[model samples]
Target chain A: MRSAADAAEPAPPVRSRPGGRTARIRTQVLDAVTAELAEHGYDGLSMDAVAARAGVHRATVYRRWQEVGGLLADLFDAAGNQRWDPRDTGSLHGDLAALNHEIQDSFTEQPSLAMALIAASFRSEEAARALRRLWDERYTQSEIIVERAIQRGELPSDVDARALLIAATAPLYHHLVLLRTPPDPHLPELAATTATLAAGAGAFTR
Target chain B: MRSAADAAEPAPPVRSRPGGRTARIRTQVLDAVTAELAEHGYDGLSMDAVAARAGVHRATVYRRWQEVGGLLADLFDAAGNQRWDPRDTGSLHGDLAALNHEIQDSFTEQPSLAMALIAASFRSEEAARALRRLWDERYTQSEIIVERAIQRGELPSDVDARALLIAATAPLYHHLVLLRTPPDPHLPELAATTATLAAGAGAFTR
Candidate 1:
């Protein structure tokens, strides 16, 4: 059976520590998995390929990750753990527009991690749940933007944060990802401005 | 080589002409493709499986479709030919809400054609391009809702129909598909209202 240490993230440690070795190996394996996923997508991803790419023993990957689920779970967990923060642009429109730009960039870039993970979710139930949880966390993190707007008297205090946030960003994804349209440089701000104006007019009140 | 009759869609045929045979075969093959995609997805889809499912000869399937790309292209073409039109609810709010409900239902239904095709697009370039064209066609058809809103003096005459329509429906997809959120009964009306209000205020004016 895998030990608790194996199931949990290793603590920060010096190179000589056992935890450091575990951390190092985990980083290498996850990085390899990311590279494989980006280059060939979830269909081409395999434990053997990941092991070879990481220069780790195949048996180790099999024993630890067990199969694709564990690998994907960890991959999504790593993403959620990243130091992501909403840009504080001193106004709701600026913050939302900046957030939209970040999302736009993520999907438009070649071999995009955002696109890879979203596509993987379609094929794997485990991956789909993981992505759902990740979005939950992201939206939770971004709720502060709405709170800031309310505090600044820019939006009604009772505006539905989730509804407004979805409005401000959904256009970019709708056009680029679903419609596969060329990125319009004006879309990010247009959507944000629309949402902000609507919020100010009490359209998104809960 | 396949005959020119086999290369194009048969005109409304009475089932006795050569084109009738071609049209019949095409319908069987495309129906099988949709069934295979809904049940097994793109990864499990194969020309052999499609042939067996359709009760057609394997060699005929190979001769006609050549590969998955041909199958997807034809499937999308069949979808584009359907006689679909936006609801005429006599007001911007009613029309937008009705359109949102259609989108919401399409994705919520079990073995959803909408969800299946969207997921398939992520895995195949041909499927992706076909989906884009299908969206382009769908958006064009739905544009009349905005035009109607303008003629009724509910929105500015110059409102960008594409942008307004995208805003009206995007929240449903963003929440359901990307965020994997549970179906919100009120989201359809809420999103439509937000977009309609914003459009009336000239946020979507070109």
Candidate 2:
């Protein structure tokens, strides 16, 4: 089903020349991991199953990944190292809405990689830590959206970056992930506008 | 080793004879399910283990509940039937903050039942539906908080109750569950206050 993660990584890593055997094998194996997670979740994820799907030797998969948890940690590590620049849409509202839309898109994808990986974290501590790092990086990277807003005079100087960012994005996660509700088209704009108004009012003041 | 749900159910059920053997047996078995889930998560949940823990005959466990998924469904049903009123602390801010605190408490308890059961939903359809119903009930009940605020002139009459409620509580879940960060003591009031201001600004107008 290749469910694990066509969407997990933003784009395909270069296919042939530069990276060599180690990199190619890792890609194949990790891609298999994502597919396995999508189809079966962590409970059904196994090294043998991943090896069979990846067409790699079981001994090789075992040597590299060691276990199912290793496969998850590496999948997240691969994702963590990907490049994801928050799109600059010129206005704070536009920028935050873009960010929320991106989140909604990832979460809504068939066999959603975001959903599978997050679900994996509950059963695997290694995967959980890796998920934490990935989110930390994404959140840190997104803060520049808020930084630009401040420079653009869209927000007050005392706005707490973490608090503001979380406020702006938390509703999407709350609605999509926690409530498991069908995607709401109004959510991206509604949440962004709420965060923008609240930020303007100094609700997220440090 | 009951990781499933000491916190899942809010309190100890009546220990003695008000409910007869059938009811008592159900409670005992469900308690065992919660404990097993708490210790091992869904991956470790088993009918045998539940039977052993509950001190009920194995045939009895199999006869009624049927399987692991059945146990989760009943636990949630039991929780769904419980009486839970959103506290009226005389103001929207106080009421929402108090609501957030209760969520935080349920999610922070040792082997947090809320976390365990929510995690289980990712694996079981029955549990997922039950969770959806439970959340629906809670959200519907909590609309009174907004209703009260509108009555008290604290917010506009057009507030989208669901949207405001999600904004008010999403951060705690985002922090404790998704981001896996330590709890911030200020979170309850902070989130409640933000939702309050945003509602006043008409950000959640339906």
Candidate 3:
């Protein structure tokens, strides 16, 4: 496998612990894997290829990742780190719109990255499992924002925080995969509108 | 290329009137293409395979689709046929929730089919293009429902219809791809909440 670290753009380390030899090597390998995923897409990303890209022995890479699927799961989670914090914007619409815009920019800006991961997930159970890890981690962070909205009475107490969060991000993906268009610049506006529609349903106060 | 059509799935016969023999063969080829896509996805699909599957000469398949991408565009349009009449329900929340639930159900009930199409979309530019065609068609249809809500004074007229639709659907895709989990049953409630929140936004009512 080639050292893929240089081939693909660097993704944020998902759960790396700093200052350890083994951890550092694993990080190196993961970086390589991510680079390859970005460059080659899933069909072309093989364990052998990743090892070569990382300048690590194929056996060493295999020892860590086990299979192509496992490696993908690890790298995907590592790359898709959700680092945003939702501060109180004091308005539900603004908060949702801001979050929506940030997320939309991340996905749509490098759509191929999202597309590759999505494609890989469909083909490999491992990729799908890995993607879930990222989704949940990010969801947890978003849940905090929704909870705050409830606490402030900006939203209904009964609204399912998780549901609203999902609704908030759904449109950008829909625009890309289904609509086959670049997400609109008005994504923040869209998020606010969705938040309003959901609120009208009494999801917020409930 | 293999005939993926379920023998039981009847092909709508082409009317004799219209484009004559050329049209008939084109329709047959497209029908065959749709069945193949449903079965094998885009990566496994090729013109040679299509020609073989359709039992038509390679020349005929080539003469029509010309490129695999073009063929997918045709099939994508064919596959996306979602029709739901708007019901005022007086309560926009309940109405939208029901719609969100239905869309989520469609994807969840057919994981393999959804996966195949989504995967195919990533591999082939044609498939992606075609997928977009279908998505836009559906989006347009769904927008009518939201538009009606605004007219009824149940929603703010300024709310972005496209955004609301995306928020309603994004979670389903996220669950399918990242979570690798079945869609949540609570999607309608989530959709309702999001809608309500958006409609309540200060920017919405004005």
Model 3: residues with Cα > 4 Å off, grouped in runs: A1-20, A79-94, A110-112, B1-17, B79-102, B110-115, B146-160, B167-180, B189-206
DockQ per model, Cα = 0.73, 0.81, 0.48
Candidate 2 is scored at a TM of 0.92
Candidates arranged by lDDT, highest first: 2, 1, 3
In CAPRI terms, model 2 is classed as high
* Residue pairs whose backbone atoms clash in candidate 2: A4-A34, A4-A35, B2-B35, B3-B37, B3-B38, B3-B39, B4-B34, B4-B37, B4-B38, B5-B34
Residues A39-158, model 2: lDDT tens digits: 776777889999999999999999988988888888877776666678899988999899888888878888687888888888789989988888887888888998999899998777
Tens digit of per-residue lDDT, candidate 1, span B69-175 = 78987777667656567889999999999988887877776766667777888888888887777777778888999888878888878788988888988888888
Highest TM-score among the candidates is held by which one?
2
DockQ winner: 2
Per-candidate TM-score, first chain only? 0.88, 0.91, 0.82
Where does candidate 2 stray beyond 4 Å?
Answer: A1-7, A13-18, B1-19
lDDT per residue for candidate 3 within B1-206, as digits (tens), equals: 00111111223433232677776776667667656766676667789887887778998778777988877666655444323354456666766776666555545553245555666677777777766666666667667777777888867777767656566556666665445566667655765555555665532433
Indicate the worst ten consecutive residues by lDDT in candidate 1 chain B.
B1-10
The worst-scoring run of ten residues by lDDT in candidate 3 chain B lies at B1-10
Interface RMSD for each candidate model? 0.8, 0.8, 3.6
| Residue-level lDDT tens digits of model 3 in A61-122 | 87878998988777766655524466567767777777766656555545256656666777
